[model samples]
Target: MLWTITIACLLLAGLIFRQSFRKRNEEIEMAGDAGLAILEFGRAFPGEAIRAVISTANGRTVFLRLHDGKAGCMNAHGHHYSCHLIEPGMVHVTGAGPKRLNVKFSNAAFEGGMFEFRDEKEAAEVSLWLLGSFMPGLAAQNPRIVGQPG
Candidate 1:
């Protein structure tokens, strides 16, 4: 009886360890894929990428900065997320004109691991407009904008 119990416990421990490893792998995979997608889809960004922020109704600010700004956050399960980034504006001085640019965004809320794109097409349209303003040449050339079907 003692040996049987010991064997069963060992098997259970091994199973648990396997599950842990699997979960870790899944997380890494999701992150890698997400990074690549963002990099590819958002390559038009000049200088550096920034994060955006969004305030939930409950006052729980789900960190949206990572989608574009600094200190961006991604949903642990990759469900609903958003971020922002600030690019150099036309008028370059403190309050000279439209001094700073603040672009906000949110990713499509996916179910489980499946991502959602509420209006990627519309977002892409806007993305192109802004990118063109800040980075005309590159934005025009890159395939991230609508004119180029970004």
Candidate 2:
């Protein structure tokens, strides 16, 4: 009788393990698709209009340039994505290499790391986006204030 109960428990554990593996595989398959990333991001932020998308080489992360001059980032997390708006004074960025950037976010929930792009130009562009996030409204508020020596 004890042996029979042990076998049943083992079978149940095996079934649970298999189910978890299947679910993880499904999530992996959904990752790295640009359209899905964009769609998910849109769903998260309905008001933001995406002007451009810069995807990492592995497609795990996507950077967005919004029409209003703000920037955003979407990172795949298991079956879903964590989306965050690059707000002014919320992020710090530095070039780690010719094609990589070391990004640090003030938000504790957001994970920041070294992001590698296809080339130096792409890295520079992302850096600009982070830098621009700090002063997107300044130019529109006072055109003379921009590019003027203090």
Candidate 3:
């Protein structure tokens, strides 16, 4: 009788283990897909570093750090560079820095994903074509942050 009970317990344990393993595999695959999506967007910065953290709000928060030699609008501008990627409800632009920025969004409420732009040269040459594609209605309402005189 004891031997039969032991065998039943072992079988139950094996089934639980298999289910746990399958769930872990699915989680890993989902993470890999998310990373791939970010990498495709990070291509805009080329060799630059991009990082993301899962936000409490359900949006994957991304921080892009670009270290090219050229000057940037943030440092040169006393006007203070700021942006709101999403409007009043879903995503909030919590912070921005010289090398880092923070954003939070509700995963269920997240309405935006990645930003894709062509290579730098082509993007610069025909920016007018792509101007309204990335962030629509943003520039029109916000005051321009002018750079300080050299």
Q: After superposition, how far is residue 3 of candidate 2 from its true place, in Å?
A: 32
The local lDDT score (0 to 100) that residue 129 gets in candidate 1 is: 38
State the TM-score for model 2. 0.72
Q: Write the per-residue lDDT of candidate 3 for residues 22-118, one digit (tens) a residue.
A: 9877654543343543454444335443322221111222222222211100110121212122222344332232322333445443333332222
lDDT of 1 by residue, 1-150 (tens): 999999999999999999999987865565445444345325533444433333222221222323221232233435223333324243111111121223433233321122222334433333333444454345436665423354
After TM-score superposition, the amount by which residue 45's alpha carbon in candidate 2 deviates from its true location, in angstroms, is 0.9
What is the TM-score of each predicted model, taking all chains together?
0.33, 0.72, 0.34
Supply every candidate's count of residue pairs whose N, Cα or C atoms clash at under 3 angstroms: 20, 0, 3
Better of 2 and 3 by TM-score: 2
lDDT of 1 at 59: 20
> lDDT-based ranking, best first?
2, 1, 3
What is the RMSD of candidate 1?
13.9
* Candidate 2 backbone collisions, by pair: none
- The per-model lDDT (C-alpha) reads 0.38, 0.82, 0.34
The C-alpha stretches of model 1 lying farther than 4 A from their native spots are 34-150
The top-ranked prediction according to TM-score is 2
